[model samples]
Target: MDKRDWLILQMVYAEKNITKAAKRLYISQPTLTYRLQQIEKEFDIKLFYRGRRGVDFTEQGELLVKYAENMLKQQQDMEELLWNTGNEVRGTLRLSVSRTFAFYQLPQVLKAFNKRFPKVEFHVNTGVNIDVIQSIYKQDAHIGIVRGDHSWPSNKKTITEENITILSYNKIDLKDLPSMRRISYKTDPTLEMVIDNWWKENFSSPPISNMNVDNVEIAKRMVLNGLGYCIAPSIVLEKNDQLHKIFLCDTTGSPIVWKTRVLYREELLELAMVREFVHFIQDYH
Candidate 1:
């Protein structure tokens, strides 16, 4: 099928309604319906079950739509590569980063990159460090910036090291306090171990109960509202205007510092745009 047909299929699967998909694609409802019918007839199978409210993909339709989505993404990437192969760096650079890096690290880098390559557009996804790593491995993102130590398939380089600290709003002494509602960053294994060791060394128990938060922004909010206190990197906690540092925790060793890095698979490392971005980061330090 044509690109339009694939686009239509993708949008239909996403929206699940002929009329809504038409509206989103800027086409008429009849045109969308006719195109869908043509696809079903060509495949000799019904793709969707029409309902009074909207539509739903059948079992076979779901499988086809999944492939259609992947095909569309590859096509977009191909077109972008062809359009941007000249002197100027241009194309959509998909990135996934942790909120910790997004707020504390990426703004300046992004500004400098934009100044250098004005045509390069960024599509960023933010989550915990683990999600960022997975995104890069899956080829859903070209690059990832995240906290803690990570080992990907190939080409992992450290960008920066962040110092972490425990913070609280209350005036209670941190020495051997057992009843504490502690908020935790849902990131890497190393960070979790560091935090666990920090607790074992400082407090009598694991801060009463631990609460895991997906987003660092929300973790800061909970600390501000007195829901719980969290241990975060100074790079992130220093920027929080609402929360105040309760104690400067003493880690036995070099402290639980997060080492932020960029990872790439061998196949993607040789791409022109990828090399430019990687070098931009490497030389920035």
Candidate 2:
């Protein structure tokens, strides 16, 4: 099968629904179905059957999926070899970055780098720190930019750090926090632990957070609207925002800081494109 055929088989098999696969491949449903029929016709075997829930692969289909996977893997390897053969640093550099970093800083970083090396392309995935780590471990991302400290067995560097702070529309007293409504946003385990530990150490009772949101941006907006106070990394704060900021600190009076770092496997540095991007990140900061 051709590369496109292999891709069609892989996407359809992975998604299990023709509609979803078609959307991912940027093709019409009719086109995807026609391509599948063509494949089955050439192989002279039924590949899959539509089911109530989704498409179910037949025995022959499963075997063909394996062959397609192997062929795609070999194709990827061949491309990597060819990319490194020439002096040009040109290839798709996969990156997994924290959603916060991706939102605030990554766009400018990419724009500047692309201006210099227009040949290189980026495939970026944004999520929490744990997701970024998992992406790197699974070899889905060549490098990861993650927030907070986590155990990674390979190469990493702390790019920046920011204080975790209590933000509010008006001045707030620490003693009065338990009575006031607070906003809590879903965050990585590391930051959660940091905030929880700080609360327990400083106060006897729990925070009365009524609003639980999915992300820091939403929680920050709630605080801005005079809804409630929120504890978050100071990176979310804009210079013009008229919010009161109270920094979290250990009993030792040291500020509790959230760190952002870049993680990578040393072996990936063999690719000149990955290596250049990594260096660009260091110099960019």
Candidate 3:
């Protein structure tokens, strides 16, 4: 019906429990229930089915939730767009970053950036490289921190580069790697092809992987426990990790390296906040 109603639907759908939603919205449970009943009656639909556990949205309710989400996003964008027109560097900065970089280095970077521009707010998301690229393409995020080798036709600057490494609790020879247990984790498809190509270059057969993990951190844990060795970018390797690092090389004896870059849409550079951030981040590394 209105902005408040839109928010009510979004929060109720997100939390699924009216009590939790009310708490988050800073309203009483009865008030939220009444609002929901009014909304349902006005639309002449059974929005949700209440149960002992929580609530399940009916088909119509799900559709309305999508509408509510879109409205809220548009509202946020309108406000940020207006802010961008001002001379002050104060607005939301939608930033998506690679998960590995988020874990290892992002906090310090954010802290320094905040010190430089205190008025700017951050709406940050972390995922793999492809997700970062997609956010920029879709304009869901103004900037993205992407990793691995990529061909971006627009504005991008390198933050850092590191070799793809074989990490182990103890030192081992490269010739023994194919026979030993190898830890594997899900990564971006581009990196997947790179690793697969590199593997085929060195060995005639597939690796003998004993463990598969959801992310690089879990695989690193397995390596630390001496379960198996893992191949990953050396960004995760730290001074205190105490793990043996073996950099992978090409057939020509050149080390295989991956880069992290800051990617942004060309037109987004017109925003003062975006321009300042793009420059600030490159100098961050």
Candidate 4:
């Protein structure tokens, strides 16, 4: 079997559903099924059994999946090694980034990087900061960009820092936080903890959340509409936005700061593409 075959097997194993896997591989459902049949015939074994919900791998199929994973990983390593030995920074750069950074910063950085290394390719995944960290730890990505502080045992560098702020359409006092309606979003856990701790330090009661949003961008919009006030990292806020903002501070009156970091395994730095991309990010802004 070739690399495409191995990739099909891996995608099928990850997605379980043939239709989903076919869509991800950019192949027709019938084509994917035919390929799977060919692979099974070549091995003389049934790799999976389709049920009402999806497909389940047999014991042999599980073994094949492991083999496919190892083969793909080795192939990637070889490719990276070859590219590293050469002077050209041409290879896939797998990256995982927090949603906020992905939305606010990644596009410009990627545009500039692509201009510099036109032959280089990117495989990017955007999620919460914890997910970004996990991707780096698992070696699923060559690099990770995360917000807030995390205790990751890897090479990391701070890219930027911003203050967490209480934002509203109109001016408000710190003591009025408990009385006002607060807009909250599901975001980085470390940021959540910081905000929670800051709120708890000054007041006996929790800040009342008026709306629950999926991301900080939405929460910021809601706050701008005068729906409610929100606690947000300053990076996501636009400078020209008319919202009144107050920087959150610790009990000693120091600003509560949020830092963005780029994380990666030390060994990945050996690859030219990874090294170049990391350097580009470090010099960005």
Candidate 5:
């Protein structure tokens, strides 16, 4: 109900233990326990299932925790709006992004943003594109950068174009690719969409000989080490020249060019800091 309660809930959810959460919050264990009891009394639901490893959230607790976290974020955003109503650009900007973009594309953009608005602070986290979108939607993060088709929701904006290719070490021959293993996205719809349209025109089946990887970097590493071939953005080649391209996919005949994007909540569009960052990246090209 109050700010402290929201903070306590978030910490408890993150740490999954009352004692540890209390210690981290600089509060006594009994006090923390009492507060949690008060929350359960107020909400009329058990919030956690105690276990030897850690506390696990009940279904209701999981839902409430997400609500509480989002509410806290909104409160923080409101406070920031009031505090910086008429001043230099300043406020915390929590941005989520995929690992590939975080490592490959974001550093330059962040450096430029920081140089332009030195007062602004950031909380950045990296994961796969799906998790990044969930972070923005949950209000755990303010913005997200990800690769997708150009056809995004009305709220999303395309930031750049990416062409994915199946590449192997230059020294290796393409004739051996069918016999060798391959690395690819794990049931990834985005890549599967590409492969579907791509393979229909080129071959009868998708690259079934390959193994699915969790991420792009691991695939690139495997390809670099000659473990297998991988399908990745052309930027990977630009970033690591030594990997050497064996072939470029002729995706011109297919609708498979991956569009990288910057997405934020539609409701936050009017916020000056948010708009500035969005427009900054939108205008980058």
Candidate 6:
């Protein structure tokens, strides 16, 4: 099988549903089916069995999936070696970044990097910190940018830190927070834990949340409208100068900090592109 065939196998294995795989591969369902049939025919074995819900890999298919993963990894290593031998830093740099960073920080970094290495291409996956870490672990992304601290069996570097604060439209006392109308939004679990811990330490009762929003941006807007207060990372409040900010601190009086970090497998650093990007980001902040 060729590179495309190997890639198809990888994508199919990653996404169990044929329709989903086809969409991700940017091909027609019929085409993907035909290709899968060809692969099975060549190997004289069924790769996967389709059920009512989705598909399950057969024994032979599972073995082939492992082989396909190794082949793809080797292919990438060979390409990296060739590029490095020639002292070139140009290739697809796959990245997984936190949703908040993707929205506020990634665009500027990409613009600067693109200017320096016009030949390099980027494939970015934006999600919560947990998803970012998972993508990196699965080799779907070459690097990850995440917020808050978590255990990772890989090389990690802290990029920056920001304070978590209680935000409101008007000046408010911390003692009154438990009784105030709070705006809550969906966020990463680590941040949620941090907020929960801080709340537990400071109040006997839970902070009343009257409004529930989908994301931090929306919650910030609601707070801007004087709907309620929110606790958010400092990055989210960079442009909101008028907002009253009361920085959260631990019992010892140190500011509660949210850190952003870059994570990658050490072996990926062998690639000149990956190494260059890592250094670029390190110097960026």
Clashes of each: 0, 0, 0, 0, 0, 0
TM-score for each candidate, following the candidate numbering: 0.77, 0.94, 0.83, 0.95, 0.75, 0.88
The models' CA-based lDDT, in order, is 0.78, 0.92, 0.91, 0.91, 0.77, 0.91
TM accuracy, model 4: 0.95
Q: Model 6 over residues 6-92: C-alpha lDDT tens digits?
A: 889989989899999999999999999999999999999999999987889999998888888889889986875776777567888
lDDT string, candidate 5, 1-285, tens digits = 798999999999999988899999999999998999999999999999899988999999988899988898788978778746877878888899877778887888888888988877888999878888888766787788887753435478888876667777655664555455778755347767765665566554445554677767777877787777776777566644577553335646443456788988777766667778898888764
Which 10-residue window of candidate 1 scores lowest in summed lDDT? 246-255
Best by lDDT: 2
What are the clashing pairs of model 6? Answer: none
Write the residue-wise lDDT of candidate 1 on 1-285 in tens digits.
Answer: 788988999899888888889999999999988998999888998998989988878998988888788888889878767865677677778889887778877888898988988888899999878889889877889888877776776888888876676666665566635666877656556777877777777666556556777866677778778887787776766543655664344654554566788887766655667778988988886
Q: lDDT-based ranking, best first?
A: 2, 6, 4, 3, 1, 5
Off by over 4 Å in 2: none
lDDT of each residue in 96-214, candidate 2, tens digit only = 99999898889989999999999999899999888999999988888999999899999998888899999999998989999999899888888899999999999899989779999
Candidate with top TM-score is 4
lDDT score, candidate 1: 0.78
**Clashing pairs in model 3?**
none
> Native-vs-model 2 lDDT?
0.92
lDDT per residue, candidate 4, 90-138, as tens digits?
9989999998999988999999999999989999999988788888878
lDDT of 4: 0.91
Q: Which tens-of-lDDT digit does each residue in 1-285 have in candidate 3?
A: 899999999999999999999999999999999999999999999999999999999999999999998998899878878888887888889999999899988888989999999999998999988788888887899999998777777889998989999999999999998899999998888777888999999889899986889999999999999999999999888778989989999999999988999998898888888999999988877
Mark the regions of model 4 whose C-alpha exceeds 4 Å error after superposition. Answer: none
Worst 10 residues of 4 by lDDT: 236-245
lDDT score for candidate 6 against the true structure: 0.91
| TM-score preference between candidates 1 and 2, better one | 2
